[model samples]
Target: MSGNTKIDVSYVAELARLELAPEEKVKLQEDMEEILGYIELLEKLDVKDIVPTAHAAPLRNIWREDKAGTPPGKDIMLENAPGLIDDELIKVPQVLPGEGMS
Candidate 1:
């Protein structure tokens, strides 16, 4: 690819939601040229037998074995609550005004 490839810096800034200053526009144009030059250099690499991949390692969920265990009772769970309670449940403020039974 030719290093002569042109980039519309102002148009790209609009699409990317950027409010670049006048000096930033000049800097961005030069930086974009360097970035495109790097891509042009990468095009010369040979990868005939190399497989394409999204990452360097395989993607999979790594999880521990699911084992049953004892859990604290409700009385113990509510011991640290800093709010009001009714029976065995903790009480909290209403999410929306005039929406709950109160």
Candidate 2:
């Protein structure tokens, strides 16, 4: 990928269903060229010994078996809340009380 070679910015934008302004098109062209140049540089690096991995970090399933159990209802959750009215909704304490401030 020669940096001197022109990247088809308009063609790429058309394929991606984009309507880039004149300034935007110029910026995108420059950006794409830089990106391609970086890729070319990476191609020159020695990666024969490096194993192919989906992620840079080791992926592990830190999960447990899903056990079938009865989940608590909304009513049960409201009962544990600080303020519980006759209505099903949980009433929370006011963030600021008028009595406290001058």
Q: Provide the overall lDDT of each model, using Cα atoms, as 2-decimal numbers.
A: 0.84, 0.80
Tens digits of per-residue lDDT for model 1, 1-102: 676769879999999999999999999999998888788986688878988887887779789789988898878888888775575667777877786776
Clashes of each: 0, 0
Q: After superposition, how far is residue 2 of candidate 1 from its true place, in Å?
A: 4.0
Best by lDDT: 1
